[model samples]
Target chain A: MSVATADGLTLAGRDRRFGLLLTAPGLLSLLIVITFPLFFTLYTSVHDYTLLTPNYDTFVGTENYQEALDEEYLPGSLWVTTKFVLASIVIEFIIGFAVALSLHATRRFGSIYYLILLAPLLINPVVVGLLWRMLLHSELGIVNYTIGLVGISPVSWLGDADVAFWTVVLTDIWHQVSFMAILLVAGLAALPREPYEAARMDGASTIRCFIHITLPLMRPVIAVAILLRLIFAIKTFDIIFIMTKGGPGTATDLISYYIYRAAFFGLDVGRASAMAAGLLVIILALTAYLYRYMNSLK
Target chain B: MRLFLSVVAALALAVSAAQAQTIRILMETVPDTRYIQELLPQFEAETGIEVEIEAISYIDMHSKLVPQLIAPEGSYDLIVVDFYWVGEFTKAGWLMPLDDLVERDGVDVDVYVPKLMDLVGRVNGVLYMLPFYNYSMALIYRQDLLDDADEQAAFQEAYGMELRVPQTWDEYWKQVEFFTRDTDGDGNRDLYGTVIQGQRGDCISMQWANYLYSQGGLYHDENWNPLLDSPEAIRAMEYYREAVEKYSPAGSEAYCFDEAFNVMAQGRAYSFVTFNILYAGFEDPESSEVAGKVGITPNPGGGLNGGWGWAIPNSSPNKEAAWTFMKWAESAAVAKERAMLGGAPTQAQIFTDSDVVAARPYYPILGEILAGTKDFPVFTYTTEFVEQVGLELNLAATGEKPVAEAMAAAQEKLHALLVKDGKIEE
Candidate 1:
């Protein structure tokens, strides 16, 4: 069944063998890093795996998932997580797109501007949280003191629950808006000049051109950028950990941190794993929905 | 020539293998760990065993250490266990009892403060660790302010009482309201009465535990039923809330130990309830603006007994080596040396050392504090309990939840957990 070619080797079989050999390392690494851990989490989710007594002997199928669902704080954590993710993503996207448009129109030293815009993103999230915590301290921080000097009252940045959630969201936006801006700017730069030229020749307004040409053409890039931010936003941990710690009565209790509390503080690794797996499912579903919607737009 | 080379290479290999057999310790980021780091060279010179330390903050230590302990062959040979966690780890079989090792080695356990030893040395009659240092809580006040004649007169006029160390919760509150005022007449209230550790988790839990105790709140009954919803417990939580909302600094509702200590150390606040180990940090002229003027005493009603201990994990490969390090570190000479370096003195005898006393005048007060100090409740779910209770306290402090509702909710949840753990009936 082999078709022989040069040097007494079958062309199709030899080509296929070489291709497999070339891609083996990549596939193997993918399996090891991603596939194995995913399956392990699923497996652990079904068992009574606790850090206290880590073993697989106890097979409590779906018990962990049921308990996690039944837990009182689970709803609150999910609600907070949804709010934080939405606020961070929506605000970041709007600001990022605006900055990206401004940068695209810039005629000067663009790299200096990029360096300025990327400064917060360049800092580690941990450092960002700490820097903001100090800067926003109600009594001692420069922010409150400066504001106070101008007759504004001190704002409890991380103390009051309503204020705390928004404070965290703003801090996140400050750290992450740059990412979206840079990504959108790249998308804007890569857009075709031909369509815009056509629109200009047609005497279309800039806003009309932007709506008709830019939005339709840049849809994929926007989709990808927003999707990535959505995924990252859902898993946000460092800011909450360093700043609010899911506190002021579970006001900022993101699901990720709640799972962490379950695993570490509660010592219930199985329940945490189930929660993680559920989050993974939710993320996948959201991604699929977004992808379908993007395709529909096209 | 080849034979001669073989003999030399074999000897080198053996020596290198011996040298590689070293012990590692996991510790909390505290001054005692710093003391150990400085003395590592001496320990190595004496025992010919190299040592390594990985220290982290209290918030991260539990999660980081637990994973390692789960491994059959642990990465660390020695670990510093906070007493609250000793019971949990021991029950899980993650730690090895050291009674036989202590007896065989003739280690003098009596050298340590008995209260500390009782707190961390054993779990259900099995000796699991050696005391490292004491962190028994104390109330630190500005001694200079108390002694000022003008301030006394002002205080007398304001409250019709002599200014002295607060002896009751009522006294503490009155002092808080009276002392918290504009210090420099800038219209911004500069001086607070005291500072609070009202941050989300461990900080608030550890701080409020003292208040809860003094006001007759217990974490649970003997039958493991949560008693947090009782009247006394609610009162205690209300008092803590008032301290944050009405009397303390503008942002005292969200503070960790460092923030509280800094407020007191900068002389912006008049008093702070904190670990006894902080006396040195307060007295350090470089760190504290009020150095040599701060005074320590037992909190108005009670203090919390707390500290860490050194233990070898069951999974550690270097058990004997770890024990050797413990013995060396806890030895009379080494302990005294650590005390001299402003380490929290765990050994009873070090408190009486004239030189040590001269260096740390607050040790006697700590000794008195120790007399009535109580350890935070220990049970199968101590860490979780603290976190849950701490969250409630923070919520009540911030006025996010009514104190009674928060306590009731905490009790309800904890009762459910106790039932799940089989500690109580449904």
Candidate 2:
């Protein structure tokens, strides 16, 4: 009886086949565009194929990987990237949290306030870079002029390594906080109001209520936001590049910019692919950890 | 109903019969669409073709073009590449040689300025791209400030010459110091000695290469070995660093071409070194504070050499059309038009055009400069070498490392690269 039933076509099997057919187009598109290119890049990492000399390509297995690990350029750029990502995400999270709390406190004009807070995120990154560059010009820009009025000497926002790095982080935070704030606002809104009300009835202080109730409830959302922002921040190229091009030194040269310089300017495709592979592994590992942590919160 | 629908479909097909060919050209300079505004209509009428001109900032355009060329895809029919990029473009086979087009079309390449033409057109005895516009760096200053200082006689006494316009590096710096003072006595220093680019990128390389070339330095020696750490090259690098530290803006290390231009034009900086392309902006009264007051001279030399020429890409699909456009664009008539529009023309004759000379008195001297301008070595790795040296120079300027040590390090890196590329024997 079991053999006869197995040999016959069943409704559940037909339904599964239909579902697979429906999803094939989407899956194929992903394979062609994303999955194929990703695997190709991984393969290229172990080969020597400078774009200029495509004919002279060869499989120099693991050499490119070893070279990237030992190269001073890669290490210097990685250090800059770590500092940029850590600083940008930490500041954005703090500011975004504060903004979220304030918005939650306000009942009137909440929608309008949110719309205004989200304005920085709406602007294009390159345009933001150009606009901020103009504002920060030492002689002709208004930023320096405003500081001058306060009796502070004009500061070079983009001309010094230390200052330029902070300025880039500041600009990244300015854009990212808006996004994080919106996420935090959702997290705050989703939270049960009864806990705060009960805590109020018990004569618990507002700070105590926040620390005990609000913070714990918002943890998962905060983790997701940080994880997403951290990954995006690590690959920052457009704004920092437009603003400084990793200038004054290699201070703002992130991993993405380094990979670009290696492939395009340095004309070393194999090394760039290897560097990119390094970034991919790190991001995937971190993402996995974050996902697990978020699931644990539930 | 079927017969009526068939008739309607036939009419739609007829309407769509007029073929419209699309052509895209990428350009870095934001030319007023009006210059070619009339020409497009005539071309479209004759050929039934549509033209799309996508103008991008110079840095952005080059960055985009580099990746596209590596793939050798014909995304653009015409592209404007710089003189330095010609080597990389040709050697990589991203560009198509145009000697056949020139011979078949009877193009008078001789009509273009000889040096500009040679720099852009030739690569290993083959014609790659045609030169478009030519530009050279110049010393721009405020004449009224110089006149008021009355330090011409003082300069003559010290240097045994009258300081009409600085002709040497030493005199130029001295003038920057002399004029950079508080004239209003308002406790606030309203003026600076000079402002020049110090950024560790293309702008710094562009400005500093002139000085490097002037000091008898070469990117590659006769043996094709990268000589970025040579004595002459180090001296040139030292000169640029000292100038920035002594006279330029406080955060001069990040200055680019635009910053240097704004400094002199806004009256914050007494003098600046900038490209002749900025003359139009410097001359506009609405845009500049020192419009009529700005004066220009040949960039003071440690010896004498500097400037840029345009080039065509080897990957151009429309070689014939490109060559035709280039020749027409650089012709005497067009050069005169370009001059009147405040563009620097390549021709020597255009400088002497009465209208051009009257509007821009420095046009004549600019011709002399362009005539004498030397080309940076044509190598596939020119950009990388410049970038490395620029980084090292910036490090030295910021006092992060000793100049000799930084130069030596850059030299070692570049040597390894050259040796690896097989441009130089190990």
Candidate 3:
């Protein structure tokens, strides 16, 4: 019995080593690509570093952070980002949920419908922005011309300050709704039909059945969808950069665009890093609150 | 066995020859890129240096090149520098001075237009770049509309001035106001008087600078105190706002260079002020509705001095080879050849070349404008200055803020920036 125990211990130790070996490459890549940059950004946030004048760098603890707080455009950009994220995510969720339900319910021609719905996802975000920029143009755009046929006057979709923000939100929704719909559709397909059928037999209407049965079961999936979309929508840059360019005035200048201008245009790496750190903290707090809510739902 | 040895020897020699040398160039996506591409084969043949060109949009070029320049070693051997970025690039020590190369190559630096040379090639009396192309803004107008007898009579009756190309800002405004009428009697007005580059980026600021400088307003005094809040500057800002809000197209608030040029080219707008490089686009029968009907004149508000130059970055390992290419490209003969190929000419002689003048009727006027062009303030913080001022100008154009308030805010921000940069005392 003592000899057998010694052999078994050796075998278990060897297995543990093999498992670690398998994951070593991934772990090393994460350390180099993710962890290093994160720490470097944090370090930079405390320095007075500008790439144009590298010799001028010196330790300035908390000074950059203080300046970020006092920045004139910070609050406005944050507000714009929040509004963009919420509006795009909410509208995308509703439309995506509806489309997912219909796709799941249809037994015939569902594959073709799914293909058609997923086509926009294949396009890059920058291309989508440029494509929509032309389409929404007041003078030469096909969209305005089409609407003009119905006696509607041309709308300055990307020109007017008041209207440009919503145009950006709508463009984002158009490009991203397919991603949400595809995820939700997979979730809907995985759900067992037993609970939904049981609710139906108990005289529950369709909406009630969905609320009590489908929705409750879909809580985990919905949480994941919402969180992923929130992360992506909050950091939106390319679309705004290519399309409106935070334009007319500062109507569409989201936090990410502002940070980009700070880092690249202003060449103030320290201040941009500080703003990035602030953004990370906000994201962490929001993520923690969301995870807690998701757990409670489960 | 003997034949096999000979073939192997020949292959080895070829590979070694091919690997001898290579130089990479980074440039903006413009007509000059195509002209250079067409001219590069001859240079490669003569010098036996492999050349690779990467051309990207103007904004992307800056973003990509600046980071590379900040690194110890960059990927590009030669880069195209915008006239406005000369101060920034020189301040950062990113560019290598070309005085030695010019002396060694026996380059005639005097061949280039003096004003353009001063604007882009020399910074603080040091030659860091070679002028490659000029984009001095010129007034492009509808010659047919201006020559119309009825329109001229109506304009004289309304504004009490000869309906000719404007010579001053006030006259320009009157022309815009008088010509903003429906030529086709459509209930919906399709024709606009003029177009303005009012987009919230560098377009508005650069366009506004023409008005600002021509009105005797300076961006900064000798002590670096901002003059944007002065009455002359305020009047210029107000005039720019009025041009966008009242005279330009309905959606002119979002018009950049492309949109503004398109409006004029499509005959939907009467005139605009833009870079002379756009003469090709306006003259092309394929892209323009008023191809032969356009006239070029000196921009009313002394056009913004703008151009690009070739500079060797300090990080470049092949600086000598890059300098060879730069000197060769900017030589008078090459400049004239490029001019004939639709590239903007930097040398004065290229403007008088028979083939170039025949190809472009505005070459003479472009030369005159390039000779007298005034540039934006040369300083390390010019980018920041343009960006902050552009934002405020856009706000005023869009009616988000009053002109005075916008200019005041811009002045305050600029003062803070200058003080922070050690350009001025607090």
Off by over 4 Å in 1: A1-14, A296-298, B1-12, B221-225, B420-423
**Tens-digit lDDT track of model 3 for B305-351:** 88888999999968878888887788777788888888888887888
Of the two candidates 1 and 2, the one with more favorable DockQ, higher being better, is: 1
Query: What TM-score, computed on C-alpha atoms, does each candidate reach?
Result: 0.96, 0.91, 0.95
Ranking by TM-score: 1, 3, 2
Isolated chain A: TM-score per model?
Answer: 0.95, 0.93, 0.94
- Model 2 chain B, poorest ten-residue lDDT window? B302-311
Clashes of each: 0, 3, 0
lDDT agreement of model 1 with the native? 0.86
lDDT of 2 at A3: 28
lDDT of 2 by residue, B1-426 (tens): 999999999988766553125556777654433354335665556555566777777677657886666664556766766776766777788776777877986866666567776676677787766665665666677777667645666666766766667777777777777666666886655587777687776777777766776577766777877787899888977877776666677677787877767777788887777676676677788879888787777676522233233344555555555555555555566667767766666565787789898977777877776765666665787667667767777777665667788778878877876776688878
Assess the local accuracy of residue A158 in candidate 3 as a C-alpha lDDT between 0 and 100: 78
Q: Which regions of candidate 3 are displaced past 4 Å? A: A1-13, A55-57, B1-20, B183-186
DockQ-best of 2 and 3:
3
Candidate 3 local lDDT, A51-163, one digit each (tens): 77764358999999999999887898999899999999999999999999999899999889988988888889989988997788666678988998887888888779989
Tens digits of lDDT, candidate 1, B128-211? 888898898988888888899998999899889888888887777788888889978877777888888788878898888888
Q: Could you say which candidate leads in lDDT?
A: 1
